[model samples]
Target: MLSEPTFSFTNFQQDAVKALLSSTGISLLAILPILILIVRQCGSAHPAPPRGCRRLGLPPGHSNLHDEFDPKYSKGTSKDVDDKGQPLWRVKALFTHPIKSCAAVELNVADVVSTGFAFDRQFCFAEQFTPDQASTSEEKTQPYWDARTLRNGHYSRLALIRPEIWVPDPAAPDYAPDLDEVRSKGVMVMYYPRPAGRGLSSYLVKLGIALRLLPRELSFSVPLVPPPDRASAYPPVPVKIWKDTPVAYDYGQHLPQSLREFLAPPDAGASRPLTLFRVDPTHHRQVFRNAPRKEELGFQPVTGFADAYPLHILNIASVHDVAARCARDIPRLSVRRFRANIIVQGPEAYAEDHWKRILIRPTGAKSDADAGVEVHVACRTMRCRLPNVDPATGIRHASEPDRTLKSYRRIDPGDPTNACLGMQCVPSVQEFVIRVGDTVSLLETGEHCYIKLLKPGEIVEGV
Candidate 1:
């Protein structure tokens, strides 16, 4: 027989005070002077409230938006302009998939208040930890495992791969769901190397040497451990791994001969080339020279990937422009190394590279006038080396025999070899649908604004 436990307010209060004193007394004492000095310094610096604090009509040091407004705010002025200073038609598209090379869900109605998206990268697959090995007795007895615990610099290789797994089915109405059901399914993972080496198979081999957990060949058989069970625990939902690799876009210019030939047909007899773009290797070299090293760069150690702060935006138009320069009907341009989030379709080739601000909205969602959630494009997307690959075909674009016939063709007898036909530098708009569109007006409270361009060679601030 069990007796019911009783609580008294007096005893509870006494116990609470005792616990607080025991746990925080030393910390509070040590931190009090530091806090006081910080407050005093801040008070003397402005004497008046900071902009965010003033907006709330609070005291100098008080603010409701403190948690919301980051110090990086107030770096620039918002603009409202059109392509030709006339109202231009614009639509917003949101790429719900933040991770590169993953399927994306487009939305007509999205909310972007202050942070990025309402539901951005909400789920991810967890790579198994070494302790998760079945051979380990300690692992067998542990009832649960945390996916985050498995993430560390030692496990950096996991960042290169995205496990092909499916999202777990939500708990049913009648019964709690078993989270492990999703993990039982095998996952498909791909790897991208630091210097852009071979895919997952090779990278795993290198990682195996670093971790000494097992041979690279054994990585496929390992099972990921689950997080410890707690009331507040919200395990990541595993996504299904499609056995086939998704179509990849390489932004870097270097391409392997085999891939290029596969994409480009020797003559018109071949099927339409699959759409792809190659990055300019020379350009990548320049970018890499200026880029900061890993130690100077900020990254999420757990994910082993660079943080989203310094996002790299690639211009679809730029790729289109480069493709147009090549012989007509060149099957595919390679874009292997450059990893990007949202690939846009518009007029200015590489126009996004020169943008100071951009806005993304859900398709058919009411404009900012109606919804408060819209993504604020903070910085320009930078360059990376993932674009270089051997052209699928053995022939180079410039070396093809078709170049002689197509390069000399004249729209009119008077047209020059390098004539600007309004089509030469036109931005490439791929056929994919976007839930959002880019914008120049960061302060506009409504939709239907025009796109504006930033100065060329202007490095995005803080990136």
Candidate 2:
């Protein structure tokens, strides 16, 4: 009788299915509220981050500096009637030096910033010779001397050290995840020619480099823009450039050992400790002389690590004139030897000498109304023995260009004893783009007498 009661297979299956369904319903009801909450959250837009946070994590190639303004405008046609039937003056070449006294970065397109080109003379190599009296107690032990340039005889090799700027591109497939980190922080990969092996090997290696057969070089990178996140890492210290003692970010601690060793080999006699320094873009070191008055400029014309003005514009025709004046045996002179930020063609020999104001129209700009950049041609650029050092070989020439230039190019009334070639300029617009084919119109011309404005009680040696 008990076995017969347990033999209802169909009814037992129905009861099992009903029990499973009841449990499943209860579980779904319990999770329904959580599921709805998640869906609502996913549909709603995310709140934007704070401005400061956004700046720290800005999109690649974007900067948040208040002074660095990016204005929107159309690049007009290059043809303009201002040429007045003369040969149209056009930008033949554009050059920027990420590191002062180093090889130039020739560009077809360059962004003009408040401090001249986007990255011109932003970084420089300096050697510590003596502790400064102005050093704070904490920094006194590791004090650094004033900034040194390629003008120093031993630093002639600096010309051989080439620097290349790398701005991250997020669109690239191999793009780094840390785009903002690389952008604001800046990246400058520098290469230096190095001798490999001995005699034949060394010669072969160098020949290969010259002939595009092999690369015998050493390279290292440094931050072109000082990282805001690591502001504390690179402490602000007073560094003298000429007579002005502006605070600069000292990258001495982070200096790569390989770079320091190469620039200042221990074997070299009495070599000072070499390190890199970057200008604080925020620091307003006004260009006192050969610059437009503050009222005329709207803002004070300032410079970073430049000898005097924000820009140095050279005329290729003038360079050719200089070459013609040089000894017949002398090789063809390169415009690069002058280290100009802008080089123009179609201008007569030394025609820039009388230029007081110039307008740089975009390649497609037809007139000033079509969006153009104005620059105050400040004064004539004074020359030193620096140009004597060949940019290609880093070898100093024995009285060639410099000697010839001094003979006839000493035309600056302010410093007539010194040779002058290029015209120092300051851009009127804070931000704009200048291209290789852009038109250069001499807006106004006047006799410019170079003058150095001195702060009260400050004495400049050998001026």
Candidate 3:
């Protein structure tokens, strides 16, 4: 027979104080500050690991080397505008994703389309799972994207292929990689599968080497809107697009058989070959983008594979602020984790939060609307745990950004726990080219909203 344990408050307090003064306790306290200092040093690295990384359960000895954010990218600054302030802020860096959740393609200049950036999130690889895999792992309970044959809708479900976007190191002896070389030839990517029966946790863990999906080896690009003959031959596959159900799209096997077999499991479990698709140019999947939902201030809200709005912007200052706060917890805090379309070095941290509308004009263009690109800041970007996953390693970090973010930015009522970082923006000027050096001018301001309110059955893909 076991006797009940008894506790006394006075006795407990005495023991606790004695324990704190013990040699073991004193040694722990002495090293605690030192351990914290070393970990905070990791804040300088790009593509950092999550807080308490040990709990994330990543593969052993994951590589930590990654390309640093270009100093030139720290190009822009902001000054207070008095009625009329000279264009103080400019586009520091521009990253466009030709495919959804793949590597980002850096661009010197990019054109804005009706939806957002041209070809941004325009292409995505859809996953097909057997009934068993779908039932066991996927969001089968949800009414949308609940197809065993094919699923497309959110990054939460999408298998994000973490291919290294930039390889800063040189391949040859006595030679260094040039910035020009990195811009031209990105990096090689290798695809490997997580252990079988691991389920969603496996997808969160990083895997893969740098590789490019090009025209060679069965990898090819098709027009956003395929030809009539081609469209008829491979008819549109009905998909659940947010509240809009049954959107038509042309689908095909974008990966070669060898690559498919490489990522396939040896166990021969129930799973289908990966299939890729692009936004149907015919339908364009026009969304009611931007605030108030009146119609993006004369511009249309259309998306290819983006979660909600087409454009997602991040500020270096904001990232720096977050990194500073949580550096002690998170080893490596980088802007790459947030993965914004445009990275601007603003006047102050979170300055972009107040911007309702901005116009990007030529460095010296006259005050003319037709001469520049205009974007309407949509809403504060609601974040998930993806940030904890390093872009280079594909391993999830321990609950850091989320933990620290919850401390201050827990303002989202829809999902109060979901923290926000960057602001989502949509193009108001339909078509225009935005360059890295383009100047930014505030066009309007308004109270920031917490969520992108949708109808009963609406959903989106993360950018």
Candidate 4:
């Protein structure tokens, strides 16, 4: 009876405290070895490589070996330009068909998902006859070694000159003309014709014969159609996007208005307009009136314009500014020579000069948060002598009244040098789809950049 006497509350509390102390003691004993092992491992571990080594592969104590291979150009940083307490505005557009001039599609929004545009100069017209700089053959095909050798100065006459046989047909299922017929007709027409000494009149006459093969008398269209499904037989080609609008090719100072007007839909019931011809705006200066002496033409000269590539880029702002200045004098100065693919509306005049890259999306694209396009800012478009030529009078001079070329002192000031800020993309048939209202995000790739249209200048030591 005494042993069973009672398990009171005090007894129960003592028993519980003893059990807890025993469990904690066992747990600590088991964890001590593990904790010591972890500490030892951590202390003996090697340190990670420096950040520069991880990124640029320049390890410490090996600077001299890599100095010779270091990049000399300036890579632009990512920053936004602010204006008047408001977020700065940026614009981006795509210019496809690099080789074929006067055919561009505008993208409001585009996805710069790759290094190059989707459809970049996929098609180009090669003259049937090759030019023999060594021979006296009137029709000589220039060598196609690289883009550097294809100087605009060497082919300046081709600007307003059209392919006598090769004409684009807008009405055709594909915009390109029938090459077989173009070749046949072009050969027949030009075989007996002699090369003209001054203007491009003879080239135009031959081009008319080529236009007969195309719908609406147009000349050519790029043959970059996508295949049905994913067929193995098809070539692995870049994706492309085509625009109905004609691309403009600037040959020095000649504005091919005939080509622009020809691309336009027939007005009411008028005959199909000629696709390739010249437009001379009377208000501007004539830069090439005295076509460089025969000797100067052989050695390519710079236009003193700064462009990433050889061609000039024209946006709405630049064109509008020119129009406003000439409104009193010429009232009809259109943006013809500044052949650019994208025509942006926002930003002040020449604002694209400061951009590094641009982003865009096509018109009516789906509203997916991740669905937009981007384009890297390769170069700034600079003014050139093309604007100095008075299209109306066909007069060429460095000083012309009411000339917009004066606005760009860097280009027209003293002697005409090819100093411009525009970017020149390589001529390829890579195609890309772009649209209006697309956001352009610019990023500088490098500082010591060269224009695509012209060859790089001799690398001289610090000026």
Candidate 5:
């Protein structure tokens, strides 16, 4: 054993070096095939995702939707121009909320009322009633009966148009051309309880039965003129919205059981009861137009359960611009986030800011362009955290759109805090019908007066 290890140190070192080089060579050879495979895959038409993977994309305020059309081509989708050389800013899409804040119904054509789009925000939900000292708790058990109410405008979440309720009320007018029904019957968002055995038969499912949506024929939030006995029968109710406390008519007395439930939340444990009310047809809330010159735009319409204006118009480019300003890749922003009654394509990003008045014309029509519906671009729509809320998914973005917008698009550049996109609009004519694929012409151009005003406290957030 003493003589056993009499080997030379040099020989041992040489053997160790050879073993290390051989191992290194083997490792490189094994990795070479993998590199070749990756290179081959890269050359293919469609690169395959790794096995066992799901689709992924950026989230809100971080990503953008890849659209094919050129944003500046205002001549509608294609260059079919009107006699005027302006780009055709065609109506990319048209949507109507048979029920405000709920899901919107895509429409080929929709009529406009003095208040807003046909049947939009005509009937909104309120929280359940918790009777005050004037009434007893027994009222909860009574169905289709008069009781105290907590109007939806009083609370944001309750008033929220839940995308979860995306399905159109089957009772609404048929998708086919049915403006006649709108005039003859009028639209009401009704809720019919599922039959007793069918389940959900209660005013609210939490009411021990389930209820489904039903579109009924009822005129609401219009004909500002009150009934002769309105003073005594339909007492003026105190509902809060923004800074104004315009008197609202208590609509509960006339509505059926189905209408009451449809306008109230299903929360069994809520502290308030759903009380239906109508917009004060006589009163109008003025938007604070922060312009150096005092220009008087005629009577503002009374907002019907809407924030401040009757209708809101948004541009797809503006939304995309807001997303691009975001720091990360964002998910495709749905038109629902804008909650716009009208979605217009064409015009560069934020171009609507300068469009003070726009005429919506039928697509490809040359002579009837001027006769088309004219809308006044009232003001830059001031924003809050509302855009951060995804109406489609009901998911809230912690930051963005608003965060990115604050950096660029300010409602009042002087304030720098107000964020806005799109324009608050009201139809110039008393009544008109706007159809999809309509072209929007810039009728009047003016600087957007960023009004230095604050929406009074106790304001509810929108979806």
Candidate 6:
């Protein structure tokens, strides 16, 4: 038998303490400070884990656990306004959807572009359809498809497909990425639930993933930026979106077979083949809704593939107000269902309804007027049943939020039949980076009537 030796100071310390107490005639109260100091120095028998490690279920330095209000993002101080002392609203959140109707990528900072956010609505899935009888020879060789999104309940499953934007890290100070390199090197990785049939093999696959022996989800990657050479070979084709037919590059040849099968599975009863498309930069489709202010704004704003306007801005408080009116059985609502690019806080519920023009600037700037980038609140975003779909679970609600919103939110003059939830916006000419916690100032407020105008031959391809 092996014996282990243990060290103890009990006897020696007790004898020493007795000798000291007797010789010095010191009371327990007199030595209390000394005893406390010794215990503190010795610490516990076992050292504790780091503060971050003590958290349950989350790894250290997780992005969700990170503090967006940290002083570093605001240049040492979190001043909401400049020297003017004007009241301002803070940017609550920033989101970019690299692919339309798919999951959004939450960002601490986002790059502003002429149309919208740098990567917002840059890619979309389309369903191939037959061309019109007036199509020319070129149309015969190349066919255009209709843009498919979560607006249609049949394709609501798209919300489950999570996309991660992988791009080159922006340099310091300005923190602007090289546009060309960002497009060339950028990749959008999408992950979805396993689409394969359930059987012995499927069970084994799921078991393997559970044990960390296999990849958790099925995934595919698409280039964030289309290569010029490949784009040229495809030739720009027209894709339909609502009332507009914008020319775009169809990357059907580049998409993987597995992704295609997953999107339109044989058992799912899909009517059309889903394909990927990127907006053609040269083909301009001006925002007809902004025509009233085009001359006053100097340039007409455009969009890549958004339904109407370039940017969609939502007020967090407004979403909460709508959710509050829902029935008790409904799940807790999230702001993500609305899918807005810039989400602002500090404003009253539905306060954006009267906003005409707004300015977004850094935390503390010298001038309030000229420091921030001006964004025009074009019109009210008409509500649709799309919001009925839950983003996290990709499950469609019977009718809670959309039903609640329509009951009291029929406020838009242009589209009085439908309810309004958010504001559609058009940004300024110059590009800028919008960081979370930046200040938002209401520049102008006025009545707005939503409008959708289609030119004579705008919807036809090769007109």
The clash count of every prediction, one per candidate, is 62, 5, 13, 110, 28, 0
Q: Write the per-residue lDDT of candidate 5 for residues 1-463, one digit (tens) a residue.
A: 3656678899999987776579666665655665455445434423222122221112223312234234443232443554675445777666655444555555566677766776565444433333452243343442322222122222322223321111222343343223322332322333232222223233322322121122212222221224443356566665544434455666656555544434333542334455656555554344433311223435445456666566788888777666556637455555566667888777776778877778887765668544787777877887776666655444557765677777667755544677778788866665778876787788888776554435455332330
Query: Candidate 6's residue-wise lDDT over 1-463, tens digit each?
Result: 9889766799878878887778354644554564455446443323232111111112323333134333222222222443565434778778888788988877777888877887788788888765542223335434557788887645787898877666555532322344443445556667776665455445554555574445545666666657655556556778877767888877776676766655666666746667788887787567765433567667778888878787899877787677667847454677788999888776777888999888888876787554888888888998889988888777788786878888999987777888999999887763788887788888999998876456445552321
What's the lDDT for residue 257 in model 1?
39
lDDT, candidate 3, 356-460, per-residue tens: 888777776766554776677878898776676665554556677878887887664545777888988877656778777677777888777565656545654
Whole-model lDDT, candidate 6? 0.70
Q: Rate the local accuracy (lDDT) of all candidates.
A: 0.30, 0.70, 0.56, 0.33, 0.52, 0.70
Which ten residues in a row are the worst by lDDT in model 4? 237-246
Candidate 5 runs further than 4 Å off: 1-88, 98-100, 126-184, 190-235, 251-270, 280-302, 324-330, 366-370, 452-463
Better candidate number, 3 or 6, judged by lDDT: 6
lDDT of 2 by residue, 276-357 (tens): 7789877758776667776876888777887778888987767777767773645656677889988777677777899989
Cα-based RMSD of candidate 4: 30.4
Per-model TM values vs. the true structure: 0.32, 0.73, 0.61, 0.37, 0.56, 0.73
* Candidate 1 overall lDDT versus native: 0.30
Every candidate's CA RMSD: 27.2, 19.7, 16.8, 30.4, 18.6, 17.2
Clashes of 1: 62
- Candidate 2 Cα outliers beyond 4 Å, as residue runs: 1-87, 131-143, 176-185, 195-215, 265-267, 367-369, 453-463
Which regions of candidate 6 fall more than 4 Å away from where they truly are? 1-88, 131-144, 169-185, 327-329, 367-370, 453-463
In model 3, the Cα lDDT at residue 346 comes to 45
